[model samples]
Target: MWLPGNTGVYLPQDDTALLIDAMLLAPIPRGARVLDIGTGSGALARAAADCGAAEVTALDVSWRALAAAFVNTRLSGRRVRLRHGDIRKCLPGRHFDVVLANPPYVPCGRGAPGRHSPARAWDAGPDGRAVLDPLCDRAPGLLSPKGMMLMVHSTLCDPEKTLVRLRDGGLKAAVVARARCPFGPVMSSRADWLERAGLIEPGQRDEELVVIRADRTR
Candidate 1:
C-alpha cells in the first residue's frame, strides 16, 4: 500500500508486513475494537479496519506519522482514529479487543534517534528494548478480557523477554509467527556497531522478526 511520505513518518516494511499477516490470521471477532500503537503509516490500522473491525484507533508519537496515517486512512476509506502522543499516556481507561504494535527495535549505540531524524522509527536503545519493555508492561492493562495483543520486533531484542513480561502481567503469550528478513538500510548501516556491541554475529546481515501473540484469558 502506497502512503504519502513525511519528514519523520516511518514507511511500511517487512516488520509491518509480518504483523499484518499475523493480524489477518488472528481470531479477531467481527466488529471488534482494535488499537494500533506506534502506528507509523497506519498500515496496521487500515488492515484491521479491512478485517472488519468496528472501531480502529491508531497512536503515534510523531506528528508527521499521525498526519500520514490520517491521509492514508481517509484515502483508503477507513475510519481510523489517529492520535499523536505517547502510547503510554494517551487514551487512559480504554481497552480494546485487539492491540497491535510494531515499534522501534533496532539496536542503536546512541540510543533513540534524534528529534528530527527519520531514524526514530527504527532506532531503539542499545538493548533494543526501549519501546518493547514499556509496551509489554502496558499490554495487559490495555486489553479487555479475552482480548489479544500482537506485537512485532526483532529477535535481537529478545522475544523471550517479551513473552515473559506479558506472562508476568497475566497474559498467555507465545511466538505465533516469524520471518527471516535481510537487514534493511538502518540495520545495514549499524551492522558494525551491532557486532561490536555483541548483539549480532560478525558478517551477519539478516535478522529474524517475530510476532508475539498475547491473550488475556479470563
Candidate 2:
C-alpha cells in the first residue's frame, strides 16, 4: 500500500526494508519471543516470524499503522500481537528474547511539520538521540537474560554517541551495517543535521545511514 509523502508505511520500499529483515534474521533464534518496536511497516515483525519467533509483539503509537500491520501480518500467514500507544509508557510487562526497533534518528527541528508526522519517527531530539535514549534505557529491564536488541539508526545521530548511550544502558552496542545514499527529503541532509547538532565540522561531507546491532550484556 502507498503511505504517501512523509507517512512511514507499514511496508516501505522493498530493498531497504528487505535488508533490515535480513539483518534481523541472522541473530534471532527460532521460537524466541520477540518485540518489534515502532513497527512502521510491520516488516520487521513479519521478519521475526520468518526467523521462527514463536510470538511477535509489534508496538506503535499510530492506530492507523497498527491496522495496517494487522492486515499485513495476516497476508503473510503469520500472527502478531499488535498494540497502539506510545511505547514508553504502555509496553507489555513481559520480557522478550529480542527487541528490535527502527526509531527516528534524525534530530528534531530539521524541517518536520509537526509532532505527529512520520517525520517524528525519524527525528530524534535536538541531538538526534531523543527517542532512542528511552528505548535503550528501558531495554535492560524489558529484555530476557541472553536476549538481544537490534536497531536501525543513522550516522546523523552520532553512532558513537548512540553506542555510548546503549553501553551506559548496559547493552554492548556496535555498528553492524552502514550505507551512504543520496539524501532524502525526510529531513535535513545528514550533513546539515549533523552540523546543526555540532556533530561534525562545517564543509565536511560524506553523510551516511546505519543499522546498529547490539546485544544485552550478559
Candidate 3:
C-alpha cells in the first residue's frame, strides 16, 4: 500500500474493503473471468485472482491508479492484467463472469473539480452519479450471461436508482452488504453542500456504504 503522495491515485479505503468482503463472500465460479472497474489500488482484482478467477482484468481511467494496481497486485503475487482505460468504452466487447466496482460516488462541490485532482477518485458531480450512472447503464453489457457484478458506493448516489437501472437492464440487483461509517475528509468538507442538496441531514456526520450485487441472468 505504498501510494505515492499527490499522485491522484485513490487509496484503498472503506468502499474498497467493503467490496472485497462482498466479493469474497460471493461464490466466484472456478476459472471465471473477472473485471475490476476503477481498479484503484488493485486490491479487489488481486482478491478475485486469489479467490479462483483464472483471468482478472483491472481497468481504470487513471493511469496512476493502474500503476498503483500494477505494483500492488504484483506485490501480492497475483497476476492481474492492468488496463489503462475503462469498461464503459468497450474493452473490445470482452465480457466477464464477475465485475468488481468501487467507482466515485461522492457528490462533488466546488473545491474539487479538476479531472487530474485526487478528488477524481471520489467526486461524482452534483448527484454523485457522474460515474455510477454510466457504470450502471453499461454494466449489464460488460457481464456475461449468468455473470454477477459487485459494486460499492455510498447511499448518497441513490442505491435505489442503481438497483432500478440494473433491473431495467435485465439484471437482478440488490443491496447485499451495508456499512455505516463516519464521514471521511472529502465528505466532511462537503457536509454543508450535501445538506443543502438534501443528500444528508443537518449534523449528519456519517454515511452509509452499500455493496450492490447485480446479476446478468439471461
Candidate 4:
C-alpha cells in the first residue's frame, strides 16, 4: 500500500481486488500453504494470511515490489515470506495448498515494457500471454493434490486460452468471476493499436477482467 515514489511496484487495482474476492470465497483448507505469485503491494498475500493460512509466500520479480510487500504484510501483522526472483527460478518442485496470481495481463505493442518501467507491472507482450502462459503452465505443478489456484486477468488476453492450458495441465479450470472495466491509462494509449491488431473493436474502451479457479485434483 505504501509504495515509494518511482519504485515501479504495482499498486493494488481492480484486478487485485477481484482476485481477493474470489480467494476469500474459496474453500481454503486448514493449515493451507498459500503462494501469492507476482505479489505487488502484498495485498493478496496479507489477505491470504488473514485466511489463517499456515504459511504464505509472496514472490515477485522486483525487489522494490518485494520490499513494498514486506512492509505491507508486516504492517498487517502477517508472517508472509517475501521472495525476490522470477517464479521459474524461485520455485522448483514447490507446491502450495492454494495459489494466487494477478500477473501482468495488459497487451503491449511493438515496444514491450522494460524491467524498470512501471508498466512492467501491467504490460504483457503482444496477446498478453507472455506472463499468463508461463503462469498457467506452472500452476498445476505449483499446487498440492486437490489444491486450488485463483488467477485474474483480462479478456483481452483470451481467458479461454488460459482455461484450456490449465485443463491440459491436468487441472479443472473455469472462469468464476468477471467484471467489465474501463481501459486504464496504458490501454487507452494503446487502444488504436489494439484495434489495428484486431484484438478489440474500434472505439471499444472497456474490457472484461476474469477470475479463473483451477483445481489440481490428482
Best by TM-score: 1
| Residue 4's lDDT in candidate 1 | 48
Error of 1 at 120 (Å): 1.9
Q: What are the TM-scores, per candidate, against the unseen true structure?
A: 0.96, 0.82, 0.94, 0.94
Lowest lDDT sum, 10 consecutive residues, model 3, at 109-118
Q: Which candidate number would show the highest lDDT if scored against the true structure?
A: 1
Against the true structure, candidate 3 reaches a TM-score of 0.94
Question: What is candidate 3's lDDT per residue for 132-187, written digit by digit as tens?
Answer: 88899998789998999999999888899999999998899999999998998889
| Count of clashing residue pairs in every prediction | 0, 6, 0, 0
Q: Summarize candidate 1's per-residue lDDT along 1-218 as a digit string, tens digits.
A: 45645445788999999999998888668999999999988899999999999999999888888888898889899999888788768788999999999998888888566676788788788899988998899998999999999999999999999999999999999999999999988899989999999999999999999999999997
Error of 2 at 87 (Å): 2.4
Locate the minimum summed-lDDT window of 10 residues in model 4. 1-10
- Compared with the true structure, what per-residue lDDT tens digits does model 2 show for residues 1-218? 33443345534542246346545555688889999888876877888897789999999887767777787788889899998877678766778898888876666654544645655556677777778778777777778888887777667677787788778878877777767654455443565656766776686564576766667667
**After superposing candidate 2, which stretches have Cα over 4 Å from the reference?**
1-25, 110-116, 188-206
For each candidate, what is the lDDT?
0.90, 0.72, 0.87, 0.88
Q: List the residue pairs that clash in candidate 4.
A: none
TM-score, prediction 4: 0.94
Model 4 per-residue lDDT at 36: 93
**Clashes by residue pair, model 1:** none
